[model samples]
Every structure is written in structure tokens, then in C-alpha cells.
Target: MIGVIATMTVQDGNGPQFEAVAAELIEKVRAQEDGNLLYQLTRSKADANVYKFMELYRDADALRAHGTSDYFRESFGKLGALLAGEPQIEYLDGV
Candidate 1:
């Protein structure tokens, strides 16, 4: 499986807003993108604004398709101003 682990830190007090948008993005992907196996958003207990996304896709094309999806493009673009720093993405191969 093609996967990605994204680490992000949101601006203070923006965690809830970011979570809401993330939830919407997940729903969109599930409903519209068949190649996406999973898209999950998580938060660190120690830091409320620290977030993570665990995603699983069929392959590179599926991963790239998600990036080009309208929901992702729009939501991710809007999230830039509310983020504390650049998101760190780690691509991986499942065993």
C-alpha cells in the first residue's frame, strides 16, 4: 500500500477549526475517491495544536489523485494561514 504520515502544528486555538476541516476532507475522499483506502486525522495529547494524518492509498497515482482533488486543494490551501509551521510529510511502503 502507498501511505503517508503528515505531521502538522496548528496555530494556537485553531486546532478545532482544523479538525473540522479535516473531517470534511475525509468524508469527501471517502465518498468521491475509491482508490483511497484510508484517511485519518489525529492529534497529540500533549499538544492540542499538534496534528497528524495517516493515509493509505492503492498506489502513487491514487496518492497524487488525492492531492489534486478539489476538497484537498481547497482545504489545504486555506489551512496555510492557520498553520504554525510547514507540514512534514513522510511517504512509506506498507510491509
Candidate 2:
């Protein structure tokens, strides 16, 4: 299994938009990706504009496939404009 953690900072006043877009992304993956083990988008209680994601895939191929997915390309392209800064991502293994 592979785990991924990501932190995203939504643009000022764009939190709601980000949430809506992210929700759509979640639904897309859930409906289409068979190798997905876990996927979640979380907002920080202490920081209104900060969001995070926890994702798990079966293996490296699953992870790589997600990158080429239509939802990923479309969502990331749109989400980038709504973010305040570059998203931080970390990969985990041997867990």
C-alpha cells in the first residue's frame, strides 16, 4: 500500500469554491478508481483556509494512474487557481 498526505491552502475568500470542487473530485475517484483504498479531504479547524488530504492506493501503479486520471487533471488545474500557495505532498511506504 502507498499513503499520501497533502496540505493545501485555499485562496482568500475561495474556501467554499474549493470545497465544492474538491467534493466533486472525491466523488469522481470513489466512483471510478478501483485501486483506491482511502481518500479524504479535510479542512483545518484552527485555520479556515487550510485543507488537507489523506489518500491511500494499492501500489505505485495505482498512484501513477491517479495522476493520469481525468478527474485529477481537471481538478488540479482548476484547484491550482483557487489555492494560495503550492500544495505540499508527502509519500509514505512500509506502513
Candidate 3:
């Protein structure tokens, strides 16, 4: 299994829009990606504008498929304008 963690900070006044878009993207990814084991969006308790995405995939191919999907591309395009800066992403391997 593969795990991915992505962190993003929303631009001022963009939290609601970001959350709405992310929710829809999450739903699409969960429903359409056969190798997606888990997909979750979470907000920081200390800062409402800080968000984290937790994802689990069956393997590297699954991860690649998720990144290349049309739905993901579309959603990311929208999400780009709402972000404060570049997102931070980390990849992990299951033990």
C-alpha cells in the first residue's frame, strides 16, 4: 500500500470555496478510483484555512492514475487559485 499526505493553506476568504471544491473532488475520486483505499480531507484545529488530505492507494499505479485522472486535473485547476502557496506532499510506504 502507499500513503500520501498533502497539506495546503487557503488564501484569505477562500476557505469555504476550497472546502466545497475539495468535498466534490473527494466524492468523485472515491467513487471512480478502484484502487483508492482511502481519501479524506481534514482541517487544522488551530487554523481554519489550513487543510490536509490523507490518501491511501493500492500501489504506485493507483497513485499515478489518481494524479492523471481528468476529474483530478479539473479540480486541481480550481483549487490552484484558492491556495496561498504551493502544496506540500509526502509519500509513504506501508510496513
Candidate 4:
């Protein structure tokens, strides 16, 4: 399995738009991706503009597929405009 944790900082006043885009992307991923074990979006209580994505995939191929998906590309393009800075991403392997 593969795990990924991505942290995103949204620009001020862009949280709502970011969340809306994220919601749609999540829905598409859940409905279309068979190898996605889990995909969750979380908001920080201490910082409303900070968000985290918890993702689990079946394998490396699955992870690659998710990254290359048209939905992901499109959503990310939309998300870029709302971000305060580049996202921080971490990839992990199961112990």
C-alpha cells in the first residue's frame, strides 16, 4: 500500500472556493478510482486556511494513476489559484 499526506495552505478569503473544488475532486476520485483505498480531506482547527489530504492507494501503480488522472489535473489547476503557497506532500510506504 501507499500513503500520502499533503498539506495545503489556502489564501485568505479563498478557503470556501478551495473546499468546494476539493469536494468535487474527492467525489470524482471516490466514484471513478478503483485503486484508491482511502481519500480524505481535513481542515485544521487552529488554522482554518490550512488543509490536509490523507490518501491511501493499493500500490505504486494506483498512486501513479491517481496522479495522472484528468480529474486530478483539472482540479489541481483550479486549486493552484487558491493556494497561498506550494503544497507540502509526503509519500509513505507501509511498515
Poorly placed runs, candidate 2 (over 4 Å): none
| Per-residue accuracy of model 1 over 1-95 as CA lDDT, tens digit each | 89899999999899888888888888999998888998888899998888989999999889989999878999898777679999999999977
Candidate 4 positional error at 4, Å = 0.5
TM-score between model 3 and native: 0.96
- Candidate 1 Cα outliers beyond 4 Å, as residue runs: none
Per-residue lDDT of candidate 4, residues 3-82 (tens digit): 99999999999999999999999999999889999999999999999999999999999999999999999999999889
Per-residue lDDT of candidate 3, residues 1-95 (tens digit): 99999999999999999999999999999899999999999999999989999999999999999999999999999998899999999999977
RMSD of each: 0.9, 0.9, 0.7, 0.7
Alpha-carbon deviation at 24 in model 3, angstroms: 1.2
Clashing pairs in 3: none
Q: Which scores higher on TM-score, 2 or 3?
A: 3
Q: Over the stretch 1-95, how does candidate 2's per-residue lDDT look in tens digits?
A: 99999899987899999999999999998888898888899999999999999999999998888989988999999899999899999999837
The residue pairs found clashing in candidate 4 are none
- Model 4: lowest-lDDT 10 consecutive positions: 86-95
